[model samples]
Target: MTEQQRKDYFDKVDKNINEFGYHLTNVFESKERPSFFYSTGIYKSFNLPEIFIPSLPHGLCCEIADNYVKAFKDKRVVPRNEKLQHLSGRFPIFLIDVPTSRLTDYVLSSVWYYKDGNYEYVQVIYPDTQGHFPNDAGYDYDQEILGEFRL
Candidate 1:
């Protein structure tokens, strides 16, 4: 999808999230079930990355990544045995908005394997903390907003 199209799609999700609190973020383009789809929790100037995580309950960052790998291996969006599929492999990608925030302790991790299943590539996108949350709470300053996109 083009940049504009991606922005538009994320905008739609943002609107839905605002109205419904949370929504299922799915990738209908994939032939097999999606291993993982981008999700976000928006509060004020922050847009936190999240996972839909059918097999596991809602969790914080990297908390449900193991479930993501199991789904990828089984080629199923919803794993059959929830109890067994409990381990988070390293994610494939990480995108952080770097220009605005003071860069520090940037780390990238990965796990590689070629298996005939699903989800070949994992995409990680992290926003620049400074760009997203420009001013700290209780600081009167000009309002600034970050670009809207899925991780």
Candidate 2:
């Protein structure tokens, strides 16, 4: 993307986020990654719960992530799974809007999770063209890794 296009895209993203009562918490950028990742949080006046998930092994983390994405794509609350509840407790849901021609209102319900106490990443649940969440069909799917950063 050209510099102008990049600016325009982020301008829209910022406007949409503000319209939705959210503000950017942090932005992750890396020379190694192809895309930029924006972390957001609800405004203070919104009175939303803040949820944090402790670091877990890769396999269990992926499982909870799959379920989390499914719940958001289906427009339902995240399921009350024992493991998820134990790890994350209760937290508010955040949204990241993606500009796509296929779906104007496309967005990802997102949260933060730690991986083995060494890495932290954002997990977002979004729908594909088939209207199905990824990793639901027994396919070995990889969640979109927004970026990797050094602390």
Candidate 3:
């Protein structure tokens, strides 16, 4: 990213967070990793863990993230390891504590935005359309695609 692009990106992140109480950082898929999106400003505003959703389409990730943040804003805290049924229709979403080791890899932007603070965040993993998670008895997906976010 160019110097000007970097400036613009931070400015947009700050603006959105100020106006919407949170912002979504979407990372598109690359040859080495699947796509993922995460929320910034939630922890800042609500003392809630930032959210991360890996290995999903951009639009779906955004929708699920919006719901999660909105619920958090209203004080509906979803416990870690709980399945949030119907939060995304047939595909129930789940949350788990994001290992700090993977933050630099999967959530670099969030890390940068927070200035590498010891803030809390969670990985928002979910099941396939068939409702099977990456580790379920019948889950289906390659470890190469999910990397360290297959929970």
Candidates' TM-scores? 0.26, 0.26, 0.85
Which tens-of-lDDT digit does each residue in 51-125 have in candidate 1?
332212234233444344333434423322122223433222222232212111111000111122212222333
Q: lDDT of each prediction vs. the true structure? A: 0.32, 0.33, 0.73
lDDT, candidate 3, 41-113, per-residue tens: 8888777888877767788878887777767767746677777775575477677776656667776656777
lDDT of 3: 0.73
Clashes of each: 9, 1, 0
- Model 3 vs truth, CA RMSD: 2.8
Which regions of candidate 2 deviate over 4 angstroms? 1-21, 25-31, 34-43, 49-123, 138-141, 145-151
Alpha-carbon runs more than 4 Å astray in model 1: 28-34, 42-49, 54-151
- Worst 10-residue lDDT window, candidate 3: 142-151
- Candidate 1 whole-model C-alpha lDDT, 0 to 1: 0.32
- Stretches of model 3 off by over 4 angstroms after superposition: 143-151
- Model 2, position 80, has a per-residue lDDT of 27
